[model samples]
Each structure stands twice: as C-alpha cells, then as structure tokens.
Target chain A: MEIPYTISTRPDTGLWNAKIGIWLFLASEVMLFGGLFSAYIFLRIDAAPGTWPHGLLNVPVGTMNTAILIMSSVTVVLAWAALKMRRYRAYWWYMLVTILCGVIFLTVKLAYEWPQKFEHFGAYIKPEALWKYEKYLGNQRRAEKGLEPRIEITGHLHSENAKEYEVALDPVNAEPDSPAMDRPHFFPLPVTDKIATIEKEDVERATMFLPTHSAYFASYFTITGLHGLHVLGGVLVFTYMWLPVSKKLYQRNPEHLANRVEVSGLFWHFVDLIWIFVFPLFYLL
Target chain B: MSLKAFHIVFIIFSTLLALGTGAWCVWVDLVEGAPIYLAGAIASFAAAIVLIVYGVWFYRKMKRLRIIT
Candidate 1:
C-alpha cells in the first residue's frame, strides 16, 4: 500500500507523481471548458441582432460569487503555507474557511439564484402577437428608444387556461417609460412585477430560464451547473483533508502530508482560475 | 509544474481577470448608464492591484519554505 514519490520528487521528472497526474487531469479540464467556451462565442456571433440575450444574469450576485471564489483561493494557498511552516492549527483554520467559502458560493447559486429563476416565466411571442397583445407590452415605448419591438415579456405567470395564459410583465425592470430599458443589454428580471393576460396561441415560446429555454439559458445552466459541481468537489476534498484521520496521517508523515496538501491546493487554484474566466464571460460581457 | 509555480500562475491569472473584467464593466456602464457596472469596475481594478501586491508577498514567503517531517 506504500507509494513512492508522494513527498519527494522523482529523479527524472523533478516532481512528485501526484503533481504530474493532476496536471494531466487539469489539461483535460482545460480542453473541456475550452470547447464549451468556443461554442458560446460562436453562438453569440451567430445570434441575430438584438435577439441575443444580455444582462439576463444578476451582475451584482455574479460579482459577489467571483469575490468569494477568489477569497477561497487565497485561503487555500494560505493553508498550504501553514502546512509548510508546520503550523497545523493554522492550516486547519485556513482550510476550514476555504471550505466554507465553497459552501457559501453553492448556497447562493442554488438556494437564491436558481430558485429565483425557476418560479419566474418568460415568453417570446409570435410575430403576429403584437396585434392582439399590444396593451400587455411596452413596445411603443421601446420603439421611441430606438430599440427593437418588444417580443419577449419576462415575469410570473398569473394564470393559464385551455385557451389563454394570464401573466404579469415588465417585472423588476425600468418603468414602462423609464430610460433604463433603452440600454443595449438585458438584465435579469425574475419576479412578479405587473400583471397582464395573453391568449395561449399568441406565444411562440416560453420558459422558466431552464437550460432548454434558449441558447443563452442553455449555456448559462450548463456552464454554471458544471462549475457548481466543481465547487462541490472542492468542498468535499477539503473537508476530508481537514478531518481527524488526515491529522493522524500528518503526524506520522509530515512531509508526505504537506505534499498531499500541495497537490490539493493546486487543484483548488485551478478551480478558482476557471471562475475568473467564467465571471466575465457569463455575467459582465 | 511545481506547486509554487502553479500558485503563481493562479495569482497571475486572477490579476488578468480582474483587469479585464474591470475594463468590461466600464464599457458596459458607458452603454447602459448603470451605477452597478460602475461599482463593478472600481471593485475589479482594486482587486487587481491587491492581487499584484499579494502575489509578490506570496512569492517571497514561499521561495524559502521546505517541508520538514
């Protein structure tokens, strides 16, 4: 059950086995995320003018998550530093904070963000829908602002029937005549703002912003969902390393334990780096 | 790569992200006139500068460390 090179570097490679293995794993991860990122770029490029969604995510929330991940990265590095200095208690506290950061990030995403998206509804009406649903939209105001006619209304479903659906719209956004909507972006509006009804036949598409909603939602859910899983993985790994059993291992082989922490730290840093790219791509730009 | 080198790369990457996102938020703010984007821009640039200082401190401290059993 003994493994060589866990602590000491290999003569030929000048590195431990775990370091090389983790690099290989991380290389594959890069390609995986790279492919999806490329797809997103193409999708954005291919979208029709003004048809592509923007500003649909909560920028402040997204930025906060970025900060949390960055802080976690710092704590994880500090944890490794403590281990190197033989400060086991300090390492434990730093690792605990790192784990808590990961937990908080996931909690905000699942408990607050995604649920906020789920209960809300959005629909892109059929082209002819304007004829009948004119009063439900603020397109007249949109036109004065030199924007495209309003084809989408995002809010909560007021009611639905065999023939029609009643809904509230213009929710959590600028007032009907407010200048904010004049901007060249779409911000997230996930709430029951104002109410209106629509004939079911008038809608061409509807969604709760799930992955199946549109290209934007699909990319949003898939990429963020995968990233969430990674955060969860980091939490689990750090938790294991912080447990009492790991302390026993550290006491018996301090160098080996330090090397193990280093390896984990490298992976955790990789996770943080990915989020750096993710934040701007998904939230800001 | 050594773990130290990897950590350096992470810090460097984080710096770049902060700078790039800051520039982007500025652009978005110009177009949308939203105060939140303005706030984002300021925060990002601050984070970038802080990371630069932190990276240097980390480098100096880590360079001499050697794990002893």
Candidate 2:
C-alpha cells in the first residue's frame, strides 16, 4: 500500500507527511535538550567559588570539532538540494562527506578528549603542609634538569605521625592502566633521586574529573553523550541511504528518495544545532 | 498561513531568540569571568548565524523554483 502525502503536502497541515513528522520529532528533541541545559545552568550557578574546574578542556581541539560539525551541516543540506535537483551522483558525494565529518568528530571525542579527561588526577591537600609541597615541587622541577635541590627539610621529618600532610600529584602518563592500577601504592611524586610517596590517607581527596567527579561533569557528559548518539544515528541513516537500496528507490521514484534525504537533512541540521550549544557550554564556559 | 511562510518565520524567530540568549550569556561571562557562560554564548551565537544564512538561502531557492510564492 502506498503512503499518501509522502511527496505532496496535505491540505490541513500544508506539509508532506514526513516533513510534519520530522518537525514533531525535532520539537521533542528541543525539550529534551532544553531540560539538560537548564540543569547545567543550575549546577553552574550553585557551584562554590573557585571549586569549579576551568582550563580542563583543550579549546583548540574543541574548536576543530565544532568546525567539522558546522561543515557537515552545510554538506547535508547540499545533499538534500542535490537530490531535489535530481543529481544523484552529487547527492551521494555530499552525503559521504557528511558521514565522514561525523566519523571524525566522534573519533576525536573518544580517542583524544575523553581519554585525556580520565587520565588527569586531582589531589586535595591539607592546609598546613600546602607551602611545603609547593616548595618541594618547585625544587623537584629544578633538580630533574640537573640543578641542586634548593629547599631542604632539616628537622626530624614528622614521618607518619603528622595529621596534616601536603597533597602531592603526578602528571598524566601515557600508560593505559596507570594511576588506576597503581592506586593502592603511594602516589609517586617526581622528586630528585628519591621516590616521594604520598599516602592516600594524608591526601584529603583524590579523583579524576570524570562524570562522577562533580555536577559540572555530570551535566557535561550527559548532554554531549546524548548529542554523540544523535550524530551516530545520522551516520547510520546516511550510510544506508548511500547504499544500493536507496539507489533502487532513486531509479523508481526519485521524489521519494529526495524526500528521504530532506527528512534526514532536517534531523542532521537539528543535531548540528544542538552541538552549537553543546560545544561552547562544555568547552568554553 | 502557507507552510513556507510559517517555516521562514519560525526560523527567523528561533535565530533571534538564540542570538539574544547567547549575547546575554556572553555579557554575563564577561562580568563574572565564568567559563560556562562564555561557552554557551559562543555556541548559541554560532548556531544562530548558521541557521539565519541557511534559512535565507533555502527561502530564495524555493521561491526561484516556484515551490513557494
């Protein structure tokens, strides 16, 4: 049975069936993202001063991904326009580029950005020993480059008896299982000729700024992860449309093919729209 | 109203709302020196501009094809 109004507009709605359907779906998508965005605003406003993490995300990398998505949006629209003009080959090329852009965006997010966040460890230190730890880190940097350690602890270093000890941190390592695998042992700080071990007890808090780390991260992951899923969906749909099945439809009824591309393009643009908000909210702010 | 007219109007209104909100966020970021507001501002503003350009182009193309009067 053929579906009516697939190619032509209905009298009441003044839009084709698929067009109205996509608009309705996009309306719901707006509400979904709107709620998450509201949560982000509340979390940011309520966060304590100086507690929220900043300079955590790499701005240049985020900007690159933003550009990729924006370009994909244009290509998707052009793909639809190509189909409208009955240019099948041009449509295929534009859709291919759109899918490739989505692939690259996801690749950068999972391979680079997400892993970088997991590798960074934050340690909270006791108030009294903060200055000592700072001095030790400064001297450690100099000593690593073959300079003499300027600062020395002269007294009977109150080894294990002291309650207030400074938080010492380690730089992010390339090892896959590091920090996590070595959690039970002391946190190894880079000191000259000696492995300075910071026991877990002395450190007030130790954690990576993962989604579980704070409310800021919780909202960040939720919003962006959902947006990523939307991109993945577009990639799958466009891939299928570029295949032979859609070619068959193109030969039989080109208008049907064009309509499908238009619908998909609408969804694709909506995805790009969401990312426009997501990029700046997570990366810049 | 015609579908084309409705769509064009909707796009224009949405773009304006996005730009207004984005500008306000940027202003807040400048005053407060907060990262979140700045990020939101930039993204919203970019989205608005892209949609505006695309909407205008789509409208012109449709008119040329006699898809909308």
Candidate 3:
C-alpha cells in the first residue's frame, strides 16, 4: 500500500525535488506525533473518566491561536500562487505577511500562554504545596467525623444473615439537628474548581499524579511545545529567505527561492494540521 | 480554474476546515470540560479524510497531464 516513487532529472527544476523532500519530512513528523498521541490514548483509557485533568486549559486563547494559524495558511497559499503567476513583488509581500502571522502566533503562545503554565508548574512542583494539600484534606476528613451528631436510638442497626437495616426512629426520640449530611469544603478543590470536591482519600489517590497531573497534561505540553518550536524554526527559515542573502540567491536562480518557499509552506501547513488533531484530543476530549 | 488553482483552493478549504473545527474543539472543552458530541473532532476528521482524497486526486490529475512525476 505504498505510493510508487518516480524520479525526475529535469534540471533540478519543477516541483520534484522540493515536493518529495517535503512529503518525506511530513512522514517523519507523522511518526513523531503519532507516538505521542498513541501514548495519550492508552493513558486516557487507563485513567478513569473526569479524572484525567482536562480542565486545566484556557479554551478561548487556544481558539484564537487556531484562527491565526488558519489565516496564516491562507496567506502562504496566496504567496505560492503569486509565484506561479510569476509576480515576484506580490509573492514577496504575501510571504512576508505569512511570516509575520507565524511570528504573532509564536509570540502569543510563548509570551502569554507559556508563562501561565510555568506558574502552574511551580505551584504543583513545590513540596510546600503538596504538604498544604495534605493538611487541608486531613482537616476535611476530621470535620466530616466531628460534624456528624451522635444520637441514641431505641432501635439500632440490626443484621440477620448478612442483611442489614437501620430501624426507623420514632419522631419523639430522634435528634432534631442531625448533622449526617454536613459537607465541609475541604481538601482544596481540584486546582481548577471545575469539578466538585471528592473524598479526602480520593484526593490523595489522585494527587499521586499531581506534580504534572495526567498523561493528558503531558500530551498537552508535549504537542504544543513541539509545535511552538516548529513555529520558531519556521520564522528563522522565512527570515533567511527574506534576507539579502536569499535575494542574492533568488537573483541567480529565482526558482530556487520559490521552491524553498514551497517546502517551508508545506511544513507550516502540516504544523497547522497537527494542531487540528491536538486541539480536540487535548481541549475537547 | 486551472488545475494548479484548483489544487490551491482545495488545500486552503481543507486547512480552514481543519482549523475551524480544531478551534471549536478547544472552545467546547473549555466550556464543558469533558467529552460530549465532539463536533470539532468530527469536523477535523472529516476534513482530514477530504484532504487526503483531494491530495490523491490532485496528484493523479497532475500526473495525467505530465505536470508532475
């Protein structure tokens, strides 16, 4: 089930060399992300529902980045089309615009989004924070035990052959202010406060994965982190191509620069494509 | 449109489909914070399938015209 390879020795021109190289590069990138995503799927299944820590992300900000990347893809295609039309001036302007979009995307992610993550990471990794979390949980459990009022009943818990029942209390004998249902807001609600407080023991159990949360957070960071790196690399590539050196190269063989842009654009589009997969799996699921 | 232009349009449309759907996924997850219908996932998967089909179709068309090897 493989596509047959064809060779072309056409003056190192046409789309042959650059197209093949980009396709191969994309294939390797597929394996890199594929492995990470597969790990995410397995961990997701292994972990219980609502326990994967999916609530840590800021959705609105991520959505904006998505729009920016899509728009950049449009600009890149326009730039490539300008080249096909042999309109060098239009091609340069569009390419510069596309590169600018990439810069904005990376700046937003690193300067804004990444710092928050670092702050959260600092809180999670601190031994003091873990100690505080434990103390809070202990207090909640103690509160639960203390809060429940003791009551003396004429009829008590009765069991026969593994069957158990509590005798119905007479209204006259019953305590008017029973505290059986008193719930204390203890254990410092799951960092996000998105979900309700679970049992003290469950909180401790979940805390084992605390330092970094779950595989979901791991994948979230790894995928986006790698994508960010790609964006940076792309900016550098475009910068070099837009520089005087690239202009000199283009003056000699203009098609070389065009081919270079085509390859870079392909990689940029692939980065956008991976985000398509990452957004859903991380933010939605 | 010529084949080249058609190819460009297909790629852009498919990419937009992927991005819009991907953003929707992030929005839903942020709002709901749990899995539901996953409309964004559905959209991206559909876009990926279409992109692949279009890629193959474009490649074949180019080959037939001897524009590409």
Question: TM-score of each candidate?
Answer: 0.91, 0.69, 0.59
Model 3, residue A1: distance off in Å is 38
Q: List pairs with backbone clashes in candidate 3.
A: none
DockQ of each two-chain model: 0.65, 0.08, 0.11
Query: What overall lDDT, based on C-alpha atoms, would model 2 receive against the true structure?
Result: 0.68
- Model 2 achieves a DockQ score of 0.08
User: On residues A1-285, what C-alpha lDDT tens digit does candidate 1 reach at each position?
Assistant: 889888788999988899899889999999998998899899999987667777777777887888898889889888888887889999999999999999999999999988877877777789877756655556777777677666777777778889876676654232445565555453464454567777678789887778777898888888888889988988999999999988998899877778888778888888888888888887767
Weakest 10 consecutive residues, lDDT, candidate 2 chain A? A149-158
**Candidate 2 residue pairs in clash (backbone atoms < 3 Å):** A280-B39, A285-B35, A285-B36
TM-score of predicted structure 2: 0.69
Q: Candidate 3 on A187-244: residue-level lDDT in tens?
A: 1122331211222222222212223645666677787889889888887887777677
Point out the higher-scoring one by TM-score: 2 or 3: 2
lDDT of 2 by residue, A22-52 (tens): 8889899999999999989888889765456
The better-scoring model by DockQ among 1 and 2 is 1
What residue runs in model 2 are displaced by over 4 Å at the alpha carbon? A126-197, B1-69
Give the residue spans of candidate 3 off by over 4 A.
Answer: A1-15, A121-211, B1-69
TM-score of chain B of each: 0.88, 0.86, 0.52
lDDT of each: 0.80, 0.68, 0.57
On a 0 to 1 DockQ scale, where is model 3? 0.11
